[model samples]
Target: MQELPGVGLVERARAVAPLIAREADEIERSRRLTPSVVAVLIENGLYRALLPQSLGGAEAPIETFMQMLEEIAKADASTAWCLGQCSVCAMIAAWLDPDTAQEIFNVAPGILAWGAIAHEARSVEGGYRVTARWDFASGSRQASWLGAHVRIVEADGTPRKNADGSPEVRTILFPVASATLHDVWQAIGLAGTGTDSYEVADLFIPERFTAFRDVPAALREPGPLYRIGTGATFSLGFAAVSLGVARATLDAAIALARAKHPSLAGTAMRDNQAVQGLIGRTEGDLRAAGAYLYATAHTMWRDLCATGEFSAAHRSAVRLAATWTIHQSAKVVDAAYHMAGATAVFRSQPFERRFRDMHAIAQQIQARDTHYEDVGKAILAGG
Candidate 1:
């Protein structure tokens, strides 16, 4: 099938869902995506969804990207999480020089992943020298390149500051071979993501390989998608992933309710009024949360495309919607898991894995309760 920018990506994702579902167990067992799953994702151009078109990417609309992730997530949350992490990382190409961007991301399987901001780079002639370790690099196992977000410090250890007097942070890019990978990703869920730690000791990165991420003045690409920024894109994509997980879990519960009968009770679960009521309420909650997330993303995307601007209000709206959707999705999964009773605790059932994945997603930084506080402060301050 021919793929066009921002077109039919959701269908492509759905087409691949069954394969992803089949590989889900192997993925968790290996703590990384299977080669088959990775090939399908790359072959379908899913990883390039957020990359600029100039770099041979889809440059898809944000809503389209979210929908695509939602579909993949219904099959496997880990696959969706890895895809979301790497796809958002591709936005850095927009802030980089054309030659540099092409050199880094134009190659086959051009995937990059990074961890949380940590440590600092000491300034040197023509580049900066970094000797720092970063953690939580989801999808790093499959990435050809890895990046580090660090504050810049001068030779004598003085900090480099922007004109506004804030300390400067830049994302430094390097080949994955330059870093020492650590196998420390043991977790309660989302094990397939390979969200591990990596370290680079006294490594030198050329100035050309660094980017001032999320800073408008440093952007080299003029696409509206980049205006949404990586952080916000991640929030939007992961929210959709949560929705997918919740949807699947609830569906599994409904199926169980229809077929399952209590040992002592005379009626099937579907005949229980309490089970019927819970299913109705949970389905409504899931659908409503998904609608709110998609509507908020579409509104921001429309205004951005027309005006070439992404307002602070737009960012706040996305943050609120994404965080709330994740929390609500978790609640849906919890209800569904409980509704499944003893079956949910067994590894053989669908509810067990999704229940764990939903909680893990909720525990992530994107789903933090502090986002609500941030949005509240922004509203009260009239932002």
Candidate 2:
């Protein structure tokens, strides 16, 4: 009921921060957002921020959407992760048939979750039949639709190939009920993301419900947001989540340092020169990383809007900024956790959960240090 109409989506996300913060404990314990929080997210239009406007969605700019994720993440990382998963799935609408896309996203929840599958889909008369178990299906608990990325094959089990002589891969969509959900999301961090593994056997997927998982030229929408492509959008948005979690952890640590006295030290942590220096330097580092992330995202978004295409430099810059931001955020969280001392290790303290969550984020593929090599290669190629 606390809807703030006429405000930007980022501001709207900020408005829900208190509620998300209040539910953080329950979310972690239950391994999913509560129904009430889900309803609030739906009512606030948070899930539709990345959807095409033609389908009753916001069609928000990439920067705005990433900022919104940051605001939500400051309250709870799991919630922010789920929001990112669902919203980015909506972006796939740009490649879907209008009728099918509308039908899938127009549902009440309109959330889609999926995972990687090693299985191959055997082509049939009208569609393909897939039997595979996908892992890391984040946000699956509340999704309306589910997807599986499969390699296409012929009836005799030979892999299908595109005109360019590459193996054809397609992401086939199916109703959430068609897949059997497994309650194996037990994780030390981001437990509330509900990133469970799912199974689908002999599930029939019509051709219209599938598309090339990474082909940008096939997108149906002409908006710049879609033009940026899913890889860049996910990297930037997830990096913002890392930054937000780091921001919250640093704030919490500062609060504890100012109030509690260390047993070994005669004075409070805030009075200790070492603690002071650590927090000060870490804050500066976080701010610098955040500035780079946002600046790169804004530049890419702007360039795509004006030119309808992104240069190799722009793509490499986005990936480099994201990888750097994630690593820096993890460092900030580690410093904050150490500064909090014994208090940080307790579940009663925010640093404990954030420390675990930040590490998990760093382990994601997008946050890997190898991305630096990709950026370096791009620079060399360009030069």
Candidate 3:
């Protein structure tokens, strides 16, 4: 292990604890991170942790990213969601040309926001004319730019052929100035994430600023961080969201339960067997989910750094593991709400908000159906 320098990540998060918690409700109400909260994140330099050191970032170990994610999520899941996407994208920036990366990190290390995950882009003159509507662009309300996806298209609209005569697909980074951020994220939970959609009409993107290739995790790029797997980024980021929500829900429930008494009897809430059972089960579930996620994340990172790549089978396994971890975390959070009785359901308490947010997170593509199918196929082929 390399010796890290300067203040620790844990310390950085501690410095912002009051800030993230202070505006969490406002974030939930407005469906976006508050300016104060963003400032705290920037000042702490959390986003800089993922970018390569050469680009004026810490390029900290992947383990640090995973653990820090859990801590941030615990404070505010929506803010963490916005934080997750930005920081995870920083890893991609680390892999980019130093010049192109400077255009992003040099201005402000942890303040850039992006949404170019899915391969929805194509090539054009000088660069690529991207034409696709990216969905669930988390934190879009405050985004300065977007890393969107595009598929190659002929001027007549038919898909174009690549060098091998196959359909060409690429991720075109469309600046926020050229795209429209649609406020479609209204929901019962995770409203603060500002997970809106964006549309681009004949947006021209230059090639120098884009990364058009297979998934980063699938790439054999000489850099160790780039070879983990194409989809692990989604898994890690979403799993961190789950851990955060579960932690928040559990904390809320405990606080309320400790203060209240069981309604039908003279017993205190904490003294009731039923309440104890709920707490026990919820805590166990949360611990298991956190443990599994951290373990798998560390393994993936270590393997990548040492081997420069991991097998496709191992990568798929990690994704499956991470997805299941999210599901488990949700179950634990729901149980926490049950332990808190009707009090947890009231809008006044954080429990209801966290519950809604967690359920919403579970429905994300990273946490839902598609991955189940992917894992099933990988299993049948022999894991």
Per-prediction CA RMSD (Å): 1.1, 2.3, 2.9
Highest-TM-score candidate: 1
Candidate order by decreasing TM-score = 1, 2, 3
Alpha-carbon deviation at 71 in model 2, angstroms: 1.0
How much lDDT does candidate 2 score? 0.88
Q: Which residue runs of candidate 2 sit more than 4 Å off their true CA positions?
A: 1-7
| lDDT per residue (tens digit) for residues 104-194 in model 1 | 8988679999999999999999999999899999999999999989999999999999999999999999999999999999988898999
Best by lDDT: 1
Model 3 RMSD in angstroms: 2.9
lDDT of 2 by residue, 344-371 (tens): 8888888888898889889988898789
lDDT of 3 by residue, 309-331 (tens): 66676577678878898899889
Error of 3 at 134 (Å): 2.4
Error of 1 at 307 (Å): 1.4
What TM-score does structure 3 among the candidates reach? 0.90
Clashes of 3: 8
Model 2 clash pairs are none
Give all candidates' CA lDDT scores: 0.95, 0.88, 0.72
